[model samples]
Target: MKLKSFAIFGTFLCTSRVTLAKSAVLDQTSLIYEFPNNTWVENIAARNNGELLLSIVGTPQLFTIDPSAPSPRQPVLIHEFTDSLDVFGIAEYQTDRFAVLTGNFSFETGDLGLGSWAVWSVDLNGVKISIVNEEPTLSSTPKVAKIADIPPAQILDGLSLLSQKQQTLLIGDLSAGVIYRLDIESGDVATVLNETFTAAVPIPHFAPSGVGGLHVRNGELFFSNVGQQKLFKVPIDEDGTPSGPVTVVASGLSTLDGYDDFTFDCAGNIFVTTGGGNSIEMICRW
Candidate 1:
């Protein structure tokens, strides 16, 4: 019984702040897993063999967790999209494949209209289960191929994986705050960075902010900005252009309000996910 707590039904606003390079001491713990409270867990990937992929917002599911399973974490349901699609920002397109980013949005009007978006290539064995009624039974799925088409003023949230040998991809346009560079073998989309930032946060209604979590280390290109709660880093020139200006790797940290999506761990540690503060925050370096 070392699994902690895992429930999933909304109401979990968390906020944290701690930055250090050589002096560490931030151990906020809460490790739970077992989704489905009307499920809404968009984006989270980690699988070199450890397994853990989750992106469930509205439906067209995709959930999996197998932390070497046995202790109490079972969260299976692996892949299932095409009810008009609704998966979002998933990466890892090589072994067992996975590079999704769909959006037709309308789980009854969570509204993401103007031009349904796409960019798929999933096949982790394709639609496994969890499509409980309302149609979608699968017959020969998973080999989806749509590639690119995001222009309704952009709302294709995050998706990184810049080169499966030049297939290229790095889209992140949370409502036109721009950061595109998709070339998925020739769909050609480019707009490197438009500098995401869109304020107004009193929360009640009025959403569609800008750029939220997108990574690409070593060549630098980290971003975040739920209405500028801040966290940026630029410099990437080898042809995928984006050289100079845009630095502020983490700023004014204090609860990190609504910045969604971010993951990195292998000891590098930096886990950020803040949907109006439903938290998943961790930043360790030391």
Candidate 2:
């Protein structure tokens, strides 16, 4: 099944295909898994063997779940960051190596603790952990490595692999409204893009967030402005620098909430998750 047709709302995971019609319709919908109430799952990443890595904000834990498992299977605990208050973005940099973002965040106030963010590397190299049936037996737990501490980032929401050979990752800073390039090998961070398209709307008594979701595809950097409810893409070089102007892919996604995380399909369809809206919206590019 194509992962682009899947979306997770709250703690429940569901899949639906978008067909060509006057109005978009979701078909083949099924719930893969569901967590307890208020278990805010922030981000998700897929493993090579089809297991899913879930990042939770409130619990500040990382979990692995098997989508192909029988209904109502419990997700296995991968690793929990004890010191962090929240886990936000996750991206598979290499084959089984995932880069995860963790920090202190306030769900009630929408505030991120300054100077309290870090990047981590979760390497699942040669490790076997059972997902279904009985209790999970971890012969060897996955290696967890701290890559770097990001002190200046306010709201780092999205992570994407910029270059595998360069060992770099692209991070979306929601508060800063810029895309940052992080050198995993050197622990260096640089702003690659800063424009009005990424700026958040100023609202009183609320922590504004702009850039939310990010992905690199077809030599272009695709990102979402959550505050603006727009999706855009721009051609970029190998070093994560913009090579062309930003072009809007979709807009006005407002349905009582803003956009959060998203993914692209092989057929060029974009699937977006609405944070509080409890719905998944799809944009088909024919």
Candidate 3:
């Protein structure tokens, strides 16, 4: 089978096939879709039904694109955020349900303006839409709950569903340089990793913290560091504790810059989004 690469620029979705030899060659190129120019796609989550959910940083909106649809495809705006909140990371909670992390911040400067943060349960069924998960009680209009009462020093950039059955989540703190595990059922949060990186490339006067993207696959947790420009994997125990030292998966690849979030295809191919460059890249072994 041939390895295919899908990259998204400002509005154009470019598809290419890579022929790996001593050097990799782009065999073909095609345009898949063209999104709105103002849409700054921060992260993407693939659904089981082959649809894609995109988080936009430029606006407080979430879009869904069905590539399997007929030609001349268009992305549908499925969700919108109010109260100046913008989605940074998203993960599938169930079939049509999703866990969305939102905060009040500037995507350009990476500055926390109001310093508000919360996790929400978004249902894509019927008329019922989004609900704040941190509410103390379940009601028709439950009050929004903050993740924690601590100071707004860390930027929660990435989120992944730890276990659907256990209702747990894994979140990465970009500024604080740590990974936190949150229990959706009990509202308990804990730190999983807290190692500081000495060789971090400062984000050019912006937030200069390590740890960018996060994903869990095959009982292991994988993360990327924008400062270190590296990707590492660690064994995660059944109880959600990281058990072993970090193993480097890939590093020093020129295609990656400010690696933000990544997802795996059905064939196990990895697709990474670079925040600094605003591009998507596909990785596969020859």
Candidate 4:
């Protein structure tokens, strides 16, 4: 019995060492572009051409900028939703076709404007418009269209393409602590996932807002719970329906403040943005 106990202790030590060694660290950093105060950049998506599409929440606007550009890179305005006050999330659904979330939200009050949440799309392959401050130079003008209004969604903070062929979008609701799947073609919305893992802890300053980062990859739906300070995944079908139980991928992340939006690289490494912590962390699978 003593020898068995020692073997267990040895295995525990080995496991702990491996876990600690596998952690990722920021070895180098570089600034690409910085927006002005109150810009409230919420979400960003990569264009097929290697440019980045930014969704600004402080203002109802979408902008695109070339990351490869030199210092002082300027983000050209793509579209400004005068009807809405803010834009939340952006995701590329097709080639140069992106889906966007917009609504009237008050930063000061931290309250969403009811009945104002809607989904919109922008096609960068549309008409050409003159460059900003550079006359005679034309850039592709985005064709903007309102897809549907989500009257039931209190705060859809994250948007992702569930399936390109099905024309379905997976929206994360921070306030509701649920995931809603929206059919882009039929304008139909349905609740797909909701459980304790997505629930937010109540705080004094603001109401409980739950899930943040959301993405679909390898037949799995991955998300981050800001209020819970954890990352979770659920096996999902092509239609965004849950096929397996929710599982915690990472937890005990109180030090990171909260996990907001994230993206998976080609190597399956998850790059998560720490919302209040003001840092980005890369989580390795191994």
Candidate 5:
């Protein structure tokens, strides 16, 4: 395991025995629902019914997975989005604020702007539902619009909401080497970290690697190290800056778009949806 420092409440402190180890051999890699080959699942948000609110490339699908039942669960297709979206980050915010980022792609110039991007929102629960796992049918066709255009630079993975610190939306731009914070109400966007996220904590050049997936718990920022396959806990200060020394929470992840979005179940088991692995992989601390 890599040696790293531990921080408390966003302040750098002493060291700990945190290992950059595999979170756990994925115990559950069950299939929720699989669409066509063009049906590449980019981001997934778990619902209360063991179902998933999923986003496919250039489209959207809502499907369910019964861990108790089987693999290749023949994802029940729900909604097919034909908006002007290219598809990327996605998240469910309470009963009202469901959000996602329409990937930054230039149909004309093909130049992915370093700042070209947009945000869309709709009522997550308010959307019509047909199956516990089937994609939610739109009650009135969910409203889609461009909020803040992201400067595209081969932007890899991202998240719509990461924390509750006054509604700050965190997004990670992989190749552009950027982390942005967006204002939920005003639709303003700003970069959060100006440093390399995937680059090892002590590495000098290349500033590590691109950011893939990030999740916020309480106030600590928990993110998967796609460049490193390690899980890290970046504690925040009173100002919410990722100031404290970072702790290697889990490690040994395959550095091949190894992860996207992850969260802890009520039982405290850390679960992550692996990218290439096509499985809902996870680790637990009991």
Candidate 6:
């Protein structure tokens, strides 16, 4: 139960040094998952076979956990949502493509919803070839391709895979806390990072709703601000284009709710997940 010891709201000010915890240091082989129907799992991706990808919220479906397969599988729904659908972000782009962001609007949208905001691709047999921007009504067959239409954007709750010398594709804009960049083979989109990280430390307010998931360790690119509990380390510029400023490491970690996504390990350690206090929080490098 270490997520800095759960429940906190010390104002949420903003930057200061940081230190206020009750729990944080877990390593049960460092794996935890509980965001199936318990709702609010937002986004998480890593499936070049490393397996562990999810995006859950009020059902629709798309969850997989193959911690090596020997026995950690019971979380496979893949992608299933019909009526007024919503599948905010999921990644695994290349070698057949898999990057989604279906929207009907929420984070803001009026009448009947269905406010689409797409950037697609699908072919692990799900077929839907190159669908970009708009146009997608559950392909699964025609192979789908090149369709553009964006704006009225609501949620694209995080997706990261930028650094293979900048293959570019990093999106997470939990309603304006912004961070966009896309080029998954040239669908073209921009806006690297925005702002919204309050939690100063016992006074600031909003902050922790964004700066969502976008893990890219080793070449650097990790984000979190779940309302300013803060955690950034962006640095990728050999042409990967993200040149300068951003290196907070970690901060007070306010209230720790369904804190969205994160991943990293190859000797740096950091694995976060807490649909607002369900579990999974392991940070290292002391």
lDDT of each: 0.62, 0.79, 0.63, 0.74, 0.53, 0.53
Looking at candidate 5, the ten consecutive residues that score lowest on lDDT are 1-10
Model 2 misplaced regions, further than 4 Å:
1-25, 131-133, 203-206, 255-257
Model 1, residue 272: distance off in Å is 12
Error of 3 at 248 (Å): 1.1
Tens digit per residue, CA lDDT, model 4, 7-66:
000011111222222244333335667665445678778777767777877688887776
**TM-score per model over all chains:** 0.31, 0.88, 0.75, 0.85, 0.67, 0.28
Q: Any runs in candidate 1 off by more than 4 Å, and if so which?
A: 1-35, 38-40, 44-134, 144-158, 161-165, 169-212, 215-222, 225-229, 233-235, 238-242, 249-258, 262-273, 276-286
How would you encode candidate 3's per-residue C-alpha lDDT over 1-286 as one tens digit per residue? Answer: 0012233422222433332232333344445466544555667776676667777664677767665555555666666778545777887766667777777767566567445666766765432222246322212331233343223425677788889888888888776778878887676778878775312356664667577789888899888887776677888885567788788776644633566577665556666655555445566532
lDDT per residue for candidate 2 within 226-267, as digits (tens), equals 777788899999989999899988875454346668987666
Q: Considering every candidate listed, which one attains the maximal lDDT?
A: 2
Candidate 2 vs candidate 6: which has greater lDDT?
Answer: 2
Angstrom error of the Cα, residue 219, model 6: value is 11
**Worst 10-residue lDDT window, candidate 1:** 1-10
lDDT of 5 by residue, 9-88 (tens): 11111223232244433232333443444345566665565445565544433333333334434444444445434566
RMSD, one per candidate, in order: 17.1, 4.7, 8.0, 10.3, 9.2, 18.6
Sort by TM-score, best first: what order? 2, 4, 3, 5, 1, 6
TM-score of 3: 0.75
Span of 10 residues, lowest total lDDT, candidate 6 = 4-13
Error of 3 at 51 (Å): 2.3
